[model samples]
Target chain A: MIPFEHIMILSAAIFLLGLIGLFVRKDALTLLVCMGLLIMAVGVLWIAVAKSFGEMLGQGVVLAIIATAFVQGCVGVMLILKLQVHKPSLQVKQFTELKG
Target chain B: MRVELFYLIAILCLFFSLGAVFSTKVVTSLFCFLGCVLTVTLLFVLLQASAIAVIYMLLFCLLVSIYWVTAIVFLPKPNKNAYSKHFLHVGVFLLLGGWLLFVLLPFLQVPAFSPAEIDHGFGSARHLVNVLFGPLRHLWYALLALILAFLISVPVLIRDNTKCGDLS
Candidate 1:
């Protein structure tokens, strides 16, 4: 059987993968998707830590997470709308037009 | 043993997290992320934090997914070429994984700190609400204020000046 620590390590691994994707992908939308993965990985880490302690009440953290996700959604919508203003393409390379 | 159950849920969370990260399709990745959150929420339940788990599932998994999908629907599909060109990223992932394993192996070999154990009373939502309203209430109100500011700023930020019906 896999140990809890092993499972946490696996989540970390997955998060690292997402991080790499976030750094390497130049496409803004793909970066957002990778960021979402990173967020999911962190949530798994939170759950693992909570379970390890044997205490309950992840409410505050959950609430905070939902709020952060909402903020991210807002930012994403704004970015897409901004993209509509400057360029039709979602590629970060094309964003060079905004460069000073 | 309870440890075994904890490990099972942890593995489920990890697998779904990995799926969420590595899946190329954005929608599929979101689904996998939802699975990951659900597993984590179950882990929270096992920890006796039913309130947190339920909130996480309801808000993060269900509601946030809807918000993200709706947001993405407005954007064009991402370019395929740049994403597929990231071969070096795989090497970076492996290196990071190895470094993490090296750092964690020693710590994992030891037993967890006893003081870190979950408190018994932590499962009660009544206590949580009471505590939040007592000391943390200000923080909650601050968050609300921040959201209000964000709502007010959206129109000023996204107004279409050109009226060309999207720059595309």
Candidate 2:
């Protein structure tokens, strides 16, 4: 078995990568993708700690989170498509007029 | 041996995740995102969360379908200036963020606490179904209803907006 700390470190690294991607990417689709990665990283972290404690709730939470992520991705894509239909662009800068 | 494989999968997951974030073309980035999800699913399998692994694999199929639809419908033009403009800033953030996570690593470490008689079948689908429909049944049903509502309302919202010329 791998040391528990190693898995924690890997999960942390993935979480950070997702955070960076969220910050750097301006496209809505890319942002949605990063959000999914972030959610996955959190699920991994939950599983790791839950395994250490010998509990099943973490896995259950992970399953729920994945389902929620699926719904979120679908809604996000639909909103993006609606935006594209109106504006014909997917760039974040193009939508800045609504920032106020 | 399994530990080594876990490490290999972790590295691949990180590499593909970075590729997904940094790729210039949208399609390439989407493909890399799929790769990252697949690698993470493999990690779940290695961790013995077979049900979550299978669920993620199914979710990955759904994601790929969404990717294809977005690719055909949106067809975003590549942002040529994104890399050159944001590379330095993101690199600095990553360096500092990584250092912070490394420093916090010791605090996050949990002592090995595996029970003597661990339930090896904890993450099986049967176990999951029992848990969801047992103690967590109400919450699960509520979430399902919410998701269904959202699914039904989104298209209606879009159509209404289009009809009202709000989106035009």
Candidate 3:
């Protein structure tokens, strides 16, 4: 079995990648994708720690997170599609005028 | 041997995730993201979370990827020049941030891996069900209610937005 520390480091790296992607990407779809990556990283961390502790709760939480992520991904895509339909663009900069 | 395999899988996941983040085309990035998910699933399997691995395979690899592909198919072709100009700056900052996290996290005294005796039913569906319905039952109900609320409200919200000419 792999060490928990290594798994934590790997997940952290992936999480950071997602964070950077969230900031660096310009498209709403890409931002949503980055969010998915961030969610996955957290799930991985949870599982790793839980496994190390020999507990089943982490697996259960990860399962719940997976379901939640699926729903979020679908809803996010729908919203992005709606925005695209209105503006014909997925660029994040295009939607900055919603201060009202 | 398992550690080496874990390292290999971890490296693959990292590489593909970077590709997913940095690839120029949306389709390419999505494919890379799929690859990253696949690698992570494999890592989960290695870590003895077979159920989580399977769930991820189903949700991320199958469901999410399909949804993304369909969305991409309907989306107008993305602008090729849509990337931010500050790539180097962002990359450097993220690297520094990650390093800082790595350095500081060990102080938290998170438990290290000390392999417990393998329970044959550890990640089985029965175990998951018991855990969910046993001690974590309240959480399960809350999550279910949240999901139901989201599902029920989204259409109404969208319809109202459209009627109000806010989401045209």
Candidate 4:
């Protein structure tokens, strides 16, 4: 049996990885992926806790989160595409302005 | 969860996430992310998500594959330099992780429960409905409505922005 703490460690490690990517990556798409990983890490914790406590609410919460993330990815990709259209670069440094 | 299988999936997932973060090629990183996502899906299954949740996860995979196609076809190549390889950035990020770990250390205990108790059916679809529509049902509906409004308004907003020639 996998203990809860082991799963905690796993989720924390994933969260740290995602947070590092979030801070270190200057590309927008990588940032999006890191952000997704961060959110997924949270979902991991939720599922772990729910399992430990024998509750089903966590799965429901995760389902809603997945739905939101799906739409978020679509919108984020569109914005990235628009940014690509406006400028040939995906550098975070260049997007300081809200203009085309 | 089975210990051997759990550790294997967890280790593989960690490695894939690292690869995604550190890979030089955009496609390489994206593919690593694909592997990472799949491993996470395994973790989800190991944790006993409902069948419906598994279906949702497959959709998530589909979305990622679409991202892969879009990245391969549309995104520019000059942005490769944007990946920061600086040790200072990495060190600082590690410190952030350490601080969070220090803060959360107290709550990281392995609670006492037999494996069977942990496997007690926890993540079914019926419970999912109860969670979303049970208590605070009004609040849930309100939140849903707000999300719906946001989704509906986005295309129109984009159309107006494009019409006005302001991509912001």
Alpha carbon deviation, residue A59, candidate 1 (Å):
5.2
| Candidates 1 and 4 compared by DockQ, better number | 4
lDDT of 4 by residue, B50-136 (tens): 443455557666666656655654544564233323323433664585467446633533222223323344455555566667875
Which scores greater on TM-score, model 1 or model 2? 2
Q: Which pairs in model 4 have colliding backbones?
A: none
TM-score of each: 0.58, 0.72, 0.71, 0.70
Query: Per-residue alpha-carbon lDDT of model 3 for A1-100, expressed as tens digits?
Result: 5778889999999999999999899977677778889998999999898889999888887987998998898888877766765677767798886643
**Any runs in candidate 1 off by more than 4 Å, and if so which?**
A1-11, A43-62, A85-90, B62-121, B137-168
Candidate 1: docking tier: acceptable
Tens digits of per-residue lDDT for model 3 on B1-168?
568768988999999989889987676677678778778876776676766776787787554455455444455446322322223343355458546744663453322211231224466556667777998878779979999999999998777734555664
Task: Report, for all candidates in order, the number of backbone clashes.
Answer: 4, 0, 0, 0
Listed models, DockQ each: 0.26, 0.54, 0.53, 0.46
Question: How many collisions between residues are there in candidate 4?
Answer: 0
Superior by lDDT: candidate 3 or candidate 4: 3
Question: Per-residue lDDT for B159 in model 2?
Answer: 77
1 versus 2: better DockQ goes to: 2
lDDT of 4 by residue, A1-70 (tens): 6789999999999899999998888877787788778877888888888778877766766776777877
Off by over 4 Å in 3: B74-120, B138-168
lDDT of 2 by residue, A65-94 (tens): 888999999988887887776687667778
RMSD list, candidates in order: 12.1, 11.2, 11.1, 11.3
lDDT of 2 by residue, B1-168 (tens): 567778888999999888888787666677678778778876776676767877887886577568546755665346434443443444366458546743663353322112211124666677767777899888878989999999999998777634545664
